[model samples]
Target chain A: MSPLLTFFLWSLLKCVVVTVVLLIGVAYTVLLERKLVGRIQNRWGPNRVGPFGLLQPLVDGAKLFLKEELIPGNVYKPLFLIAPIIALGCALISISVVPFGGPFTIWGSPNLFQISDVNFGLLVILGITSIGIYGIALAGWSSNNKFSLLGALRSSAQMISYELALGLSLVGVGMRAGSLNLRVIIESQTSNKGLLSWNIFGGMQFFAFFLYLMAAYAETNRSPFDLPEAESELVAGYHTEYSSMKFAMFFMAEYANMITVGCVATMLFLGGWTSPFGNLVPMPHNTFLLGLVQAFGPIMWFVIKVFSFLFLYVWVRGTLPRFRYDQLMGFGWRVLLPLTILNIVGSSLWFAYHS
Target chain B: MLLIIFILFAGLCLAGAINLLLQTHPINSALSLIVVMVSLAVLYLTLGAEFLAAAQVIVYAGAIMVLFTFVVMLLNAGKEERTLGSFASWSVGFPAVAVILAVIASVLIKSQGLGTVHLSDKITSTQELSAMLFKELVLPFEVTSVLVLIAILGAVALARRGDGERKGGQ
Candidate 1:
């Protein structure tokens, strides 16, 4: 194949595979949240479907697909349709930049795990997510409903506020790694010192990580930060007017955003694609077994780390009560922002002194 | 591929700007402006200024525009009330704007040799930009930060209601 053709084909293949995997992942995430939250509430969640409700997402997807698409007469029609598409599209596109596993040969063709390894993958993810606020905002406004608009507005405000802490928290990770590429960050974390060398272990960014954890919860519109769509207050919030698949898109967007944030946290702090033992685990000499290990091992570790973060998301949702409106904003601005600034300054000095 | 994307997004930018003008409601105009800002970000990416592209999206399209939308939504802004065009708007205003656009287009055409960006001319990485800002341009950067600090203070003072007023409204 011509180089350009090879590049295009490889990218196309990666995009398809990533999108499919991510969509299925998002579906199961919903199932996971329901089941886990159900357990927390002392209930069996969705056991009616195939084998402990593994097929629940499939059933839910079908129902959404077959259901009616309603457009209220009062809606500003064009934006009402476009907002959820943009929301979901932005959520999905952020995945294209995330690194999942190491490179390996596939049927004699050498392939690296990521779709595209941009130099500024982290910032690109940040920028894409920052734009995601539009979906909720436009959804609420275009819905021509007070509750929807209020929900959307609150969500946008929360995201904008928390984004500062989120972005600042990552700077410590990036600075420690000395690179913004997700792959490079992972490589930096593969310490011979085993698990102790991961950013959260001996790394000084633990406080930053804590800050990021809180901000990420708000960013994903999860509970204790989910004031925008709080059932008692906003009455379904931004998606209140949405029905069927339109609502489903917003629902999937939330899960997808959660997954994206989880992946970022894993990549930055928990050592992405690296085993707990780091490079200490001896590799088998057999090429085929090694290949299988290399291919699946990293993916398995990554999924485990990501799953842990998602579990944290659910745990927080179950554990904490949602913050009141002014309290949420106050915490974001008065607390998180100042702490992030302090962290940036402190880390800079720490790095300089250590160097 | 480069030319294709440039044409596609440049057209989008123009379309977005035109939409901003044509939209009746303030919210629609604000969204259109976001479309333009996002298109500009893409243009920056194509021009090999990745940092600027991200900043364009993050700061302009993301932060500032969200605030604009918030205010517009909060006010429940309706479609802009149309007014009768003055005789001078069609005669003097249109021509003046047209002349300005023509001059800009002429300068742009003349600068094609300089503006033509080959793929190899790409400088999308942030290293050089950061180096330039932190090393050679540090003073200006600090000055800008100070300016921003002042602006924040000004905004806070202006927006904060006095203790006497706060309780009365509540």
Candidate 2:
């Protein structure tokens, strides 16, 4: 095969693998949330599906798929059909640029554990996520339902407001790394001091991380900030009119976004796939053993970090009460926005002085 | 490959523009405008202006068009009826646009310095772009930001006045 053909095939294969893994991850995240929240609420969650509800997501998927798809009367046809796709597409697209493991050689060519290593991977993610608001917005509008519209309006306002803080909180990290590339950003966190060198510790970005976490929670419409889909008020929010697989798409998109957010948090603040011990943990000198460790170690660390982050997400969901709509808006703008700006300035000064 | 992608996006951009004009419903038109903005961003990427491309998507297609959609949705605007143009506008607008296009085309064709453009493979990094904006064109950049700030203040002032008048009336 020509070099170009080989490259194309490899990329195609990588895309397939990453996508399948992500979908599985999203499915399992749903199970994890249900189980965790159930435990928190003093009840069992999906115990019968398969061994602690391991097969719950698959069964849920099949049920959603087999259910009757409903296209409500008096709804705008095109946009109603297209909204969930836009949401899910944007959610999945953002993950394409995230690196899950360290680089490894395949077929005499070096490859990162991501589908693409765009120069502005971080910016691409932000842009795609910002675009994702349209999905909820359009879904509500096209649904022609008052509850859906109100939910979407609140969601759009909340998301756009929180996005400012979310984007600004990362500016300090980007400034420290001196690049927008995800891999470079992760590598910049490397240090013999290990956990201390991560942005939240020695980098003095714990405040920014706090801002990012809050904003991320708000951005994903997770607990405490989930005013958009508040069950009491909105009755399922933007996907109110959607049924069957369409509703599943929105559900999957939400979980997928959570996973993506977790991945990004793992990368930006937790030093990515690097161990907390860093170089303190010695590796094997033998080539074969080194290769095996190198291939698996970073990935294991990455999964652990991401899993913990998701646990935190669920924990917060169980612990906190949802913010009122006005409070959500006020906190995003009045509190988070200014603090993030302050963090940028403070980090800039710190980096300059330290350098 | 770049040329093909450019042509595809450029065609989509033009199609979206036409669709924007053709669509009677305000929401559809707004969505078409988004399509135009996104395709144009892709065209910018094809030209190797990565930062500009990202900004176009984030700022124009994502933020601005979203606000446009928000407003349309809030107003619950329906399909507008098509009407024939007035004689005065049809006579003046077409000739004026033609004259402007003619002038631009003539200038481009006649200028010796305006050679055929080539798309280079070299990508423009954000650092270089920032250097140009902050270092070489610092005054203009600051001036532009100040201008935006002024516009924002003017809007706020207008909104506040409207609120005060409403409160006084109440």
Candidate 3:
């Protein structure tokens, strides 16, 4: 095959694999969310679905598939239909640039674990994820319902406001690493000092990481920042009029965003896929499996880190009460924004001094 | 390759402008604006500023345009007003004449150049463009902050109710 054809086919295959894996991940994330929330609330969550409720997400999927899709008469038909697809599509597109693991040797040529390694990978992810907000806004507007419109407006403002903090918070990470490439950032974390050399504790990088986590939660519209979907005020927020698989798409998009944020946090702060103590303790010389183990090290570390963040997401959802709209906005614009700027200035000053 | 993409992008831009003009509904006009924004982003990509292109799409198309569309929807601005007598004709005629003149000037300029400027693919790629933006175009980059400030002042002025007009308030 020609190189172009090979590249095309490789990208296509990677898309399929990532889509399947993400779909499964989205499914289980809901289960994990519920199970974790249940434990926090002192209740058994979906125990009867399968062994340890492993099949609950499957059951939930079937139910959503079977549910009736209602298109209200007042809606702008075309836009209403297209909104969810756009949301899901943008959400999924971001994963392509993310390196899940280091390069794997494929058919004699070295194949990178990611679908594509664009030079502006981080910016692309940010761009696509930002675009995902339109789906929610459009859905609410197209529904032609009062509550939905209000929810959509709130969401649009909230997202734009918080996104400033979210983007700024990562500036320090980009600055310190002196590279935008995700793999390069990850590789920088590994050294003889082990994971302590990771960006989280790499001098003043922790402030940026903390700001990033907070802004990330708000960006993903998780608890305390989920006014867009505030049940008491706006019925079901943007997707109030939606049902069936259409509704499921919004849910999946949220979880997918969670995963994306988790992955980014891991890549930026937690040394990506690098083993914590593995760097400190050198391996025995010249073992075949040692190479294999080291090869898979980052991927394993990345997965574990991502899952831990996901759990933190659930824990926050369970523990914290939702923020009122005023509080949410106040925190975003007043608190987070200033802190992010401070973090940036501090990081820049620290870098200047150190370098 | 860059020229081909640019040509396609220009066509999309024209289509989007036409849609904005011809489409009766405000919502459709908003959607067309998004199409225009996205096309501009493609143009940015062809010029090689991938980061700026992405930022353009995300900030303008994704965030700002959504706000515009939401406001349009809130205002329920689809109703057509009956055309005022000769004012409508003047509105259509003057803009058309100006556009025609602008097009003629552009075509004349293109013909005068005689295709001396061979559009290099390397010059239009993202890395090259970004280097140009941050290094060579730094002044214009800083000037954009002034432009944004002007826009802010313009918006505030437009939104403020006149003191003289308040005398007639109920």
User: What TM-score, computed on C-alpha atoms, does each candidate reach?
Assistant: 0.93, 0.97, 0.89
Docking class of 2: medium
Per-prediction TM-score, chain B alone: 0.78, 0.91, 0.62
Residues B1-170, candidate 3: write the lDDT tens digits. Answer: 67898899989998999998788778888889888998999887776666778789878987788778768867767745545459877999989999999998899887864644443533343456668889999999889989999999988786675644676684
lDDT of 2 by residue, A59-147 (tens): 99999999999999999999999999999999988999999998877784447588888999999999999999999999999999999
Clashes of 2: 0
Model 2: pairs clashing at backbone N, Cα or C within 3 Å? none
Q: What is the DockQ of candidate 3?
A: 0.52
Worst 10 residues of 1 chain A by lDDT: A103-112
For candidate 3, the per-residue lDDT at A17 reads: 91
Q: By TM-score, is 1 or 2 better?
A: 2
**Which runs in model 1 stand beyond 4 Å of their true positions?**
A105-111, B87-119, B161-170
Q: Against the true structure, what is every candidate's RMSD?
A: 2.7, 1.6, 3.5
Q: What tens-digit string does per-residue lDDT give for candidate 3 at A119-167?
A: 7778888888888888988888889888888888888888888989998
Best by DockQ: 2
- Clashing residue pairs in candidate 3 are A273-A298, B48-B125, B48-B126
**Lowest lDDT 10-mer window, candidate 2 chain A?**
A103-112
Question: What C-alpha lDDT, on a 0 to 100 scale, does residue B164 get in candidate 2?
Answer: 100
Instruction: Kindly list the per-residue Cα lDDT of model 1 for residues A176-223, writing each as its tens digit.
Output: 888788888888888787678888875688889899999999998999
- Assess the local accuracy of residue A206 in candidate 3 as a C-alpha lDDT between 0 and 100: 90
DockQ of all models, two decimals each: 0.73, 0.75, 0.52
Please report the TM-score between candidate 3 and the true structure. Answer: 0.89
